[model samples]
Target chain A: MPNKGDFWEVNCYNNSLMYSHHTKQKSLACLALLFFHVLLQAQSPENDFLRSTGKIYSVVAGIVIVFAGLAIYLWRLDRKLTKLEKHINDEHETS
Target chain B: MEGFTDEPGVDLVKPEGIRFPYRSILNETIRNTFFHVALWMAMFSLYLVGLYHAILYLRTSRKDHDLWSEAYNKAGILFGIMGIATGSLWARYTWGSWWTNDIKLNMATIAMFIYFGYVILRSSFTDEEKKARVSAVFSIFAFVALIPLVFVIPRLTDSLHPGNGGNPALGGEDLDHTLRLFFYPSIIALFLIGCWLAQLKFRLLKLSDRVLKNR
Candidate 1:
């Protein structure tokens, strides 16, 4: 009787702890990348130099969009970190 | 009775502690993955780089370009070994075989061997300048041959390797969206890490050259 309850209790505890911290951080990064990817796709030119030529153009366009999004995200992240650093330095000076 | 009896005041000895950072993403095992993917990507990237150096060697007949060409060729071979080891482990899990004669697999093997011969050709020459020049020419030829062996040949034949003759490389039901989510990031991260390692290697080579000349 004790063993049965022990197994059930363990299962319940495991179910509650669904996502780990690492997985959460990875998910956030993925979401940021996907959001930028969608924005890029929407803003992409219809009569583009590569896309207008052939089927391979779509593949090329997709690659360009993904990389551009990645670049933009990295740039913004760098800027945010710089601002955070400056804020921290200002606080230190004030104290 | 003596063997079974415990000595008075005897204490169990514990092994030395090795602590790893809790937040660190890079571990000893994860480092292997970096080497694996980096070598493959570097092998591919350096092949292209060597191609450019080869062209320069052919057109200009400059020894510096030839030196760089030989360096890239050497780097490519080193990475190829890492790639094959990583791929063999990857295959064990995914393909249920350590080695397969799949079109892509065979093509990659041939491409690696072709570059291996490039190293052999360099060693065959005794004269420094002549060795570099001949090696550069061979590197260029190997680079050209790589295009067909690694890419075109695999694409022309049906095989289990991703993005070969039968199916699109990243497309298809095999690499579902779930896998792509992790796979794409892995590719980019691994490629960047590869470049970093190659730069380090090139710097070490330059330093070693200086040391050798001084001695």
Candidate 2:
């Protein structure tokens, strides 16, 4: 037979393991609750319809293109200004 | 309805699931995350650029550095205002009020006042060199003050805002994976736009300076 000390030690180890396992499962359940909340929010019919038709991407593409164009234009303007500043400094020095 | 994916890279996780996380009140308005959070991030970035120019002005006493600092500060303040406006709207939608007694909000207001004072302080000095020196020093001090006021204090105490007071509103289980794609881009876009605005303003300041010299 196992010694009394050995028995208690094994019992304690099992109890601690059980406790941790229980907590882990509880936390997992909480995560599921949280994701369920997100799922519910996304259940709107109109939003679903738009996504299903892939039409939402047209809007996304349009926005992306416009913003990209604007960024390019701004970058060119910045370069022009830098050149102008250099030209002005040259004129002033020559004068 | 069938889930569709015309774009290959876009999410097709579920027929009905939005790839973004959601809280009850923040449901659809979670889209505002791009605007509200990105504006503050952009503002902080622009302010850092401004502070760098401010330090450069102090070191070199260059007129262009002073003007650049002023332009960056103006753009930073503009984004700050946009941040506050978007935040207030988000607050009203979720927290049921446009303003609240939250520590973060109050501290942010104080930070704005400090920067605004920096502008007024600069304008008060008649001498150009004196204005640049004093304002540059003030900008450095204000930025230092902002760190503790806006960021540090909020984390150290209980807060109703997400990511504070043990709230699970921002990290781990809260921020959805797909949102990162849009969120990061929003920050980059806003920062670029703010810098663009600053550059434009800098050009105007330089042009006016040139005209004044010519006259």
Candidate 3:
């Protein structure tokens, strides 16, 4: 389903329009991956050095989760638009 | 500014303690002074701008003024929310919980809800003039209510947050000379950022209005 408050997606009529969102999607994914790597290190005994710094770093984890959620949301937006594009293209083909 | 060399009243050498205070429980998280506290100041500045525009909209009946007011209100709400998030984190470390029952926090939350009501009131109207008129009125009242909810009522009663009956704000050792240098700048910086966000929102609203008008 189309999401609410989708201003950019409203006027998407070309490939570049979709790719604009695709580029952001990748960046968001990379950021989440970077956080994942850091969190992985934190799980280890030897690499748990960040634990000594206190609760400030947990805010970083919260930020990572927010970015991850945005990435997922963008992926869903891409999928929804692609489905609509396919439907329109199929209709043109049958005609 | 970088070297502080030959600057009067500023210790060029290792003369005095100017770093963040080592408060119990607060510790290094006192660094949040720049982020959490400044955010509220920024939010307050944005809401003040919004309040001004709201009155202008009422006086001139210009749709642009109404939109500008709404934009600033939106930006103010965003900063307020971010302030809440950063404050929650700071509280977690210092207050030992994510939230607590305090006059300050509760009143601030109420202030936010009143601002949120402005948005709801704006969205409720389908007619352009009706929305603008009501939104302008609502935003003005929201900001007026915000003053007491955030600043006045909190000081009247006891609060775990600073600026309380006993714990006077901007008076303690928590904010030192070094912190003052960064904290004041952060408020202005974040206030500019909030205005920029409001400008962006205003553009978006104008675009949407134009698009819908064309249809």
Candidate 4:
């Protein structure tokens, strides 16, 4: 969990926000400081608790369904652009 | 659709191989950490990209930069809608409410409204230069406002969301190494998806502009 104080810096440290001089650069400076703090913390991964019997995979499945819909939207958009490009090409060739 | 791969890679499964840490209320839904949380991060990143392009448009007054600015903003808004929808569902299951008075939740709604205003403000002007200039300024102001509304104020106040009230949700108190395995990659994947959407929109915008010029 990240703290509320340096949360902005932590989120931006790795993102591609070149510089805003006024607003962005200041956040970048904060990102550098928080990067070190996250590194030094040690935590164990092992615990003998709940396993997959709880149907967590259903949640994952639902998410996949949502993304699949997004994929279809992209595919249709790509097809429309392709058709437009072909029309533009045909016009140029005839001219 | 015919050539589309169903998923990136099959999810790895083995008996007693690895497991996500369990919490009382968030037991199975902890897996949502990978998807729901990552969606918001991707939305934020796309907004930053939009903000960067808006700044470029203002500085150079380049037509290409203006198109790029609008394209990324559109992608960011799309992802933001997804994020809000997913978070609302998760809240319903976990927080027992479709919407809450939680400061973060309310602030996020306000942030979305601000971006929606950008779209409305941008579309009202028919003159290309005027649209670009005014929307560019609005993008800057909107992003500036977003930083505080989504980031600063939520943290300062008590929020039901983790990373508030001394509960860090990432790799902190709630997240474990096993969850990190899925969480980090999910954020990158969603971020790439947002970028791809922006690029597709930019290409379409450029082609339409060319068509208009030729006409």
Candidate 5:
């Protein structure tokens, strides 16, 4: 025992919910597709591992080079410091 | 205290002036480097330890081995949490996000949870031996899962995470040459500190065991 207006309102509400649900599902699917597309674009040049490995090697090399530079700097500084200390000691001994 | 020190081979006289290492002069602000890198190094090390224990536990079926594995697994998870916090703070300045969906970031989150599941699985078991053994196996699997989640899958997919998908790691570009001067040393020092902490925790466990045996 439902009036025509009541039936119409209920139908409208149900339709809206269904529409929203459908759009949400579609949106999720679109997102997944987009994610895959981005990944493909990123890796499209070559195999993923190859590209990543190259980057890793470059990073490792850079780290090595930087460390080498630091070592040289420290070594030179140590030598200079040693020379200064010896000079000061010689002056002190002479006095 | 003074009389006792002079009495024997033990010379406990304090030095006139304390000289700290050049690195120590960097101070507590430099502590962030330790706090950040140590956690990750510990996390990586413990994961390897857990993996080793898992294999041993499978071969020998020893409960103690399983316990050792579980302890390291727990430690790894704890360190992983610390790592995330430190990394987030570092990122707030560097990447400008409290959190990012970057590959490395997301993979780290996944890695944390995967090991956390090992703890959860351990809790679910009622029997002590069963819990240890089951958790040991789970830890191994979790480590395996971690490889793909962290290294493989993330790289295969697009990610903002450094060191993946042709993006440079946090060495040259992101961390400048000047920063690298401090950063590399910091990594080594922090790693040593992590080993020290883990060793201490392991020793504490052994001490607890001894006390319990005496009781």
Candidate 6:
């Protein structure tokens, strides 16, 4: 992925080309190449398929399920302990 | 100044860019550095607390101390598992595999096994005092062993993991100022949450012990 740095470099290269013969045509050619570079990047299928279709929601859902399981298990264990405490207190009171 | 040297194709006379360094392999998933690395950091901090409680148990021989140690250790192991999972996910995207033969990963598994053995050893003893004493000793041994297994040995050998065998890990070009902003906060948050879980587990265990004694 050509970042801003690459764009800056291309602009610098374009400035250097300004001193050469047929300056206007060459500069226009560089401009065309820059547009093509951006177009190629926009059309790239590498990471876009998952991201654009929002299929990453599946991954997020899986993680959320795991976390929810842990939380629910902890909550149940806490409730069990509370019940056990109450049962023990009732037994002592009856005795 | 540092940003200028980040990209190879960038012209020397051009101004520095605002965006992150776009490496060929680690394009956007480099953000995983914060999540994955922070989990490991939180795990280590929790383990250190567990070790401290183990030492305290050995000194005081208190049942509560043992429970605290066990709770913290369990919480720490949970964080370690999360770290490994996140790391594997990040690896799948960057390294083309969920798991690799990297020395760091091997050593991490070993470290986890050593801690698991500590828990298994604790469960084998029926007597509370005996279990506490034996596990405290084992905890200390495992902590010392893990230092070499996880940190020292991995760095000594050639590995795909960064910061080992000439690879620069985070803080040395891998992590930059922008990444650090998120990374440090993630570490702090994970650590706090781990501690909270440990505290909850310890209280639950303590309450169970009291109920058993009352019965």
lDDT measured at residue B114 in model 1 versus the true structure, 0 to 100: 90
Which tens-of-lDDT digit does each residue in A4-44 have in candidate 6?
45545655766765566674786677775876575556435
Residue B169, model 6: lDDT of: 55
Q: Write the per-residue lDDT of candidate 2 for residues B71-106, one digit (tens) a residue.
A: 899788777776776667556545767799998889
The CAPRI classification for model 2 reads as incorrect
lDDT of each: 0.55, 0.70, 0.68, 0.73, 0.56, 0.71
What DockQ class does candidate 6 belong to? incorrect
lDDT of each residue in B13-80, candidate 6, tens digit only: 22366554444445454456566777788888888988999999988888888998998888887777
Q: Residue B42 in model 2: shift from native, Å?
A: 0.5
TM-score, B chain, candidate 1?
Answer: 0.68
lDDT string, candidate 1, A6-94, tens digits: 43454454444455466576675665466555444432543222222222233333334334433553465466556655755675787
Residue ranges of candidate 1 with Cα displaced over 4 Å: A1-95, B1-39, B167-185, B204-215
**Candidate closer to the true structure by TM-score (higher is better), 1 or 3:** 3
Per-residue lDDT of B1-215 in model 1, one digit per residue for the tens? 01111121112222355321111111112223333444566578867777788789878987667666766665566557657766665454345467988877788898888988987888798787788777777887888898888768777667754333553554474333433454566656645544544454455445445444554
What TM-score would you report for chain A in candidate 3?
0.47
Candidate closer to the true structure by TM-score (higher is better), 5 or 6: 6
Clashing pairs in 5: none
Which parts of model 2 have CA positions greater than 4 angstroms off?
A1-95, B1-18, B166-174
Error of 2 at A20 (Å): 73
Question: What is candidate 2's lDDT per residue for A54-74, written digit by digit as tens?
Answer: 233323333454355446656
- lDDT by residue (tens digit), candidate 3, B1-215: 02212232221122365644444444355567777788889899999999999999999998899989988898888788877777775565567567988777888999999988888888888899989988888887888899889887877777776434544565474356677898899899878977876786687677657545754
In model 1, the clashing pairs are B163-B169
| Every prediction: chain A TM-score | 0.43, 0.41, 0.47, 0.45, 0.43, 0.41
What value does the lDDT take at residue A86 in candidate 6? 88
Q: What tens digits encode model 3's per-residue C-alpha lDDT throughout A10-81? A: 233223434556658776566556555544444444213222354345445434433443355346546655
Q: lDDT score, residue B154, model 3?
A: 78
Give the residue spans of candidate 5 off by over 4 A: A1-95, B1-38, B162-164, B167-185, B204-215
